[model samples]
Target: MTTETSPDEHQQQEIRLALSEIPSRLEALHFVTADARTPATVPNHQGRDEPTSIFNSYSPHLDNITNIALFHNEDQTPMPSPDEIIISQRGRRRFNNGSSPDSGSTPLRMPFQRTPTKVPLSTSMILRSSPRKRLTMGSTPPEPEPTVMPSPTKPRQRLWRQGLPPAKKLRMIEEGGKPIAQLNEETPLSLLLQGMSQQQLIRLIVGDLVAGDAETELRLRTRLPMPDINPMEEELLHAKRQIFRSLPTSRLCKKTDSSAYSRAALHLNEFKRLLTAHTKQLYDSANWDALLDYVTMAWPILRATPHWDSATHNVTRRQCFKLLACHCLAAVKNGGPLLGMVRLQATDKNLRDWARDFDDIQSCQSALSKAISKGRATL
Candidate 1:
């Protein structure tokens, strides 16, 4: 056979021999593919050092493999199969004794006792798990130390009585309508006002007037004398200017804009107040001639002022006409026949239209007619 062999046959034979050596060279191949971070060696089931295979390094299904070649040479001991490598949930290596064939051989101390994790067990679980203790005849079972649950903390008071101003504190500390500790809650308002100086009392009164106390305001205005009309006219002109200026620059879809409406309302209210104060002054001073003329002048201006029902227009109109009616009645009674003729003319010209809406004005109109008829009859 050697004499008959050709160069091609010998080359083919050598190729098959090289192919047979590949399985034996797998460890060197594994070593080359592995990084320098590979662990050098690990203990096998026989307690002997063995090299790790490439499969052991990267494979997640290690437990499934039955046979694996992890040795560089045939003489070296084989690495433990995947079954012998028991990994716990904590990733610690635990060796199984049954992995070794020799049953009589002593097992190595593998440090397999896992340290338990501590958790907060509830009181009921602990009580159920605990052993029952017997109480002796002479001793009463120790009463469980009462669980002192902490009381709920109170919310802090933002406005305690002590935090009040000194004057306010004194006012709150009254007893039985008498001054205790300077002032008491039970004390009469008159007594309190008496203690205040005239200037202080006047300041308080003025503040109430400015704050729009209607009753107090009415009483005060009834006694107030009319100041010069020149200043009042100037104020009216200024208020008209402010009202016109307060109109919004933008076009609105509604009848009025809110901010513009509020500003206009304030100005209208001021205008009405001024007119009312002056009218009341005329009536209070018994100047019937002046009041009649003032009403004629003021009415047209009030009627001309721009206002929605939401503003003060309707209220001002009603109030102004009522004052006019009262003036006319007084004139018919006290102003004699000459003033009666003047009032009669004023009512027919200026107020007849307003009489339809206002009951008071309508009554005044009827009264004026009756008086005129009565004067004619007496003549």
Candidate 2:
């Protein structure tokens, strides 16, 4: 106690003391980790020992927690000793060796190089290997046998040749009334008409007796005079005829060309306008049947030409409205239900819209109910 310690000795003694405290520190850490609430003594940052709750005294490091969770077994059993782990690894290697190569348990083995064996040549083999010999100028080649061509096929007999007369003979018969000559498949109506006069033709068409003298029969046949048509009506009829003829042809060509379809649509619009004007006149005159017929004819044309401009579409809707209104009035006058007429002419969606467009929903519903009630009452 009286001797003074050298600086080097003092330093070594301090290091020993610090090393001696490591076991206590580790023991305290173990207890703290085992139970966070366990009381433990740990040195604070100020180098003073403090007794406190383990979790409060020493916070667990993230690395230590991660290590404990990762290495810990499900049953909390102790880890295997080093010798046992090494033996288990060896056992796994042995087990993998017995597993199927496709199971991916074993590494692929290097393939061995195989040396090819040489085969000895024989006399037959040498002969087979030699080039084949071909016929030379000295050899006499046999002449090929002459081929016999099949006999020319017999001309097929015509189906009409058995009993029918020739086309020329039939034409002669038709033109000159030859009793001996009969009709062949080739005889045409034009040829038959060639022998008859206009009066005979008229008599034939009228289904009158042409057996009597032609002039007398013609004089006897009653003829109705054609009605006179005004220039405007005639022009309208011609335009309607042209449009009717053009519609079918346009429908056929519309698939190949858009312009054709557009032209067809334009023609349909014009036709609709003419029909609308005509139908209005017919409506004013109380010609419901004629209006119905006009509507029926126009429906097919409208359905055929699908591409319609806004103007055409509006006109079509208006036309539908007028037609429906006329039909309703006609039905009411005839003591029939408007509902039946509407159902017959248009679809449900159109009926609903037409009802709304012509009248309010409540009025339409009431009208429909009255029409239905009337229909029931009549029954």
Strongest candidate by lDDT: 1
- lDDT per residue for candidate 2 within 1-379, as digits (tens), equals 5999999997777566655665655554543443333335566432345223333433565346434644442544555876675455444244345455565843322122122123342423321211212122122346589999988999897967677777663353455564531445477778867888867777776565646567765676545332222443544555545544654464355432445444455555575566557656656655444444443444333333343344544455456445545554453344335335454333323446545454432233444455556766665
Best by TM-score: 1
Candidate 2, superposed: residue stretches over 4 Å from native: 1-258, 287-301, 308-369
Clashing pairs in 1: 174-184, 174-185
Name the TM-score of candidate 1: 0.37
lDDT of 1 by residue, 29-122 (tens): 4443223233333323222353333444554433222123333334446456444444322365456568668744643333433322333434
CA lDDT of every candidate: 0.56, 0.48
- What would you estimate as the lDDT of candidate 1? 0.56
Clashes of each: 2, 0
TM-score of 2: 0.24
